[model samples]
Target: MRKIRNSEELLGQGDIASRRIVLEIADRTLDRLDSYRRIRSIMRMEGSVLHIGTRSWDLSKKRNVYLLGAGKACNHMAMAVDHVLGDRLTRGVAIVKISEETDRLNKTEVFVGGHPLPNEEGLCASKKMIEIVDHAGPDDLFIAVISGGSSALMSCPIDGISLQDEIDTTDILLKSGAGIVEVNAVRRHISALNGGMLAKRIQAVGAELIGFGISDAVGSPATGDIAVPYAAYKSTPIGPDPTTLDDARATIVNFDVADRLPKSVVDYLMNAGPDKETPKAFLDNTYFLLNTLPDSCIYAKEACEEMGIPAIIVTSFLEGESRDAGTFFASMAREIQSYGNPVKPPCVMLSSGEVTTQILDNSSIKGHGGPGQEMTVSFAITAAKTKGACLLSIDSEGTDGTTKVAGGITDSSSLKAAAGKGVSLYQSLREHSCFEALSAIGSTIFTGNTGTNLCDLNILFVPAIEGGR
Candidate 1:
């Protein structure tokens, strides 16, 4: 992370410059939503009927093919699979909350579902997904698309569990500030569909499982997800302060107390025990690291450089509570503008990572703001009130949270909205109400689902001119 120095002077055009920085940030974030990198990761040669990951089986025997996908990126992954090897896919189904409105796959059916919270709709689809993979013959192939929001969006609870229980546990884990590992650790035990629950399902179906993960978690497949991570713990949970969402746990079904999760899943989560020797069915399949956070960070950084600004990828995963992380990022931007040490005069300290906002008060409201947008505005307010630096943050996916405002921008004028409304910026943050401030001024960025989930991005732009009108 580089720092830049700031010496305030009255620059009449400062506002325009700030606006450019903000728009550029939004455009660049959306531009990277290209599907090529993803398609390439899941793509293969035409006519190559052979499996993608290492084959656990001897190549001599031919196998039936059955495909299944579950997650925000699953359907898209399914589309790419069809492109790579069309007509080969026997049958498949996918779950995507938003994209299902238009996702059209020749062989795969797209089911619309909810996110951050699973609904009856998603649970129902997940059941059929299990059946698709379950019927795979010992010689059949199963490709599971595990991505960022899969845990919640693709919830197919076990026989004894209810969707409400899954949601409740999520609430408890999130409010507890538990990292994705602990959260998922607990989730693995609660659901019959996660923590290798699906793998176990595949085994029973006698299918060879090939997981294609669009890991939304920080550590990629190491956490057991290319996009979900069931293998690594370098993850720092998004610690939202004390919240009311804790109530979500009150619904867990009783039998969840003791369930024997797939031993392989448990061992993998513990980061111990060797992988299962390929059961005769899977003797022909294995896993692969198709993508990770670093890939998207590099892409964003290059775009910033092209804009003629110095760029440093601060961190691939800046995980922590929103307020604390916001404060830390605020200080970093101030250092860049006032000191010019880690980053130079005209630079954008770009960042990509996850942040969680706990249930502050369910009794109140959804707060009209997402943590990503709040962070951008929060950093701007914390930036020494000087005239040089500008901060803009956006969820790469286009939808930041309960509110659809992808993200927001901050500059000297950010405080104006609240002041105009006779509400202080500090008060808004106290209430988690950045939307009231950012939206009033038209600085909040919005682009319906960018279709890419590399997590969120924050950019701090240091300036050549410290003062701007």
Candidate 2:
């Protein structure tokens, strides 16, 4: 299936050739990073033995097999495992950001949870997972599928902390312009399920854990030999947490959100003793690293090569304000087109990372949008100087911020198109309403439940200058 649902509409406007190339690369890259296909390739069942990568487990010797997962990509990951285990799987519980109609599961129960913020439904689903784990014994086997956004999708706050507190904390951290690592640091400390706390619980019961994880952390290295056991896995609910309580406290102080965050969260992070720290390591559990942040760029570069388009992976660690990044891409396009500084024009620049948008006041939000939408809007404004320069910025998980769409695609003509429709791109950025502005110009890209979550995947296509003007 096509990952870009609105490709036809997106291609009809501003720099059609460039938009087509950007969308094509994006479509192929998303398909390559699909967790469902990746999981199926490395896991299967042979008689009573479970084969994953280079390891094999005799289920006949185990009492029961259980599946537990939560994340934006859990729908596909959990479905793959459910199909593999079949009836041998005793029970399964998966909390996903959006449960698609295409999802088919036999024994796994699906829960539609919130992302970017924890909700009551996620809290309930988390409680159910805890119940399942508490009853499990040493003879039981657990297969965990974890990915980015699990921190919010599987929400179970520790004692003295409320679910709303976690929700508020997440919202605050996301808007505070703090990087995802710092935000997760604070979140992992207060949650009962996150920061390897769930793995600790399973370990306490002596249950065997086999983890399939996709690391969305920025600057995460590319994974190799995914079938083998990964000894360096960390974070999420199923692995050891690399973050410390001190890190969490430091984030609060650094972002200066202590007054805005819930008092319960502040008090817990400040006063929690060393015993309250999240698990540092888990030696007994087995883990398989699937995709990382750089995988998106790697796949995109290959796609560009297949299309015979020169492509350069600028950076996999792109960060900072979203609008500024867009402007920078525009400047890079100008240089590439005029002087071929980085690379010649008619080339594609690929980058993957988590770019943030800082909104200090809630009253400033007039409509809705995310970092991807804002970035594309800003690019459209500055890219007018370079003809046929197109940019596509997406969350890569199919949902960009508050909007239902994946992200936005815009080119040099996009700003003019917005003006024709009486939509002010500048005012939209100021109001944090890029979704509305892009939607008016038919530039929004919609792909629901993309089956991957590697944060932002940015593609910039700069066509050769028409007349050197």
Top candidate when judged by TM-score against the true structure: 2
Task: Tell me the alpha-carbon RMSD of every candidate.
Answer: 8.5, 0.9
Error (Å) of candidate 1 at residue 212 is 1.8
Model 2: CA > 4 A from native:
none
lDDT of 1 by residue, 1-469 (tens): 0000011221122366865764565466455543434555434653444544323333234365555666555555667765555666677777775774545577777776677667887888888876676556777776656556767777865545567766765655565555555565556544556555566667776666666554566654322223322232221111111111121122121223222333333333334223421111223335444455555667667777777666888887777766566667767766666677686567777777787766534554435777786686676567646565677677766667667666766676666644775756676677777787676665676655455666777777767555321
**Per-residue alpha-carbon lDDT of model 2 for 1-469, expressed as tens digits?**
3889988888777789889999999999999999999999999999999999999999999999999999998999999999999989999999999888999999999998888888888999999999999999999999999988899999999988888888999999999989988999999999899999999999999999999999998867998888888888975899888889999999999999999999999998999999999998898999998899999999999999999999999999999999999999988998888888788778999998989999999999999999999999999999988888999999998999987899999998999999999999999999999999999999999999888899999999998866655
Please give the TM-score that candidate 2 achieves against the real structure: 0.99
lDDT value, candidate 1, whole model? 0.58
Candidates in order have lDDT scores of 0.58, 0.92
Error of 2 at 43 (Å): 0.7
| Model 2, residue 205: C-alpha shift (Å) | 0.4
Collision count of model 1: 44
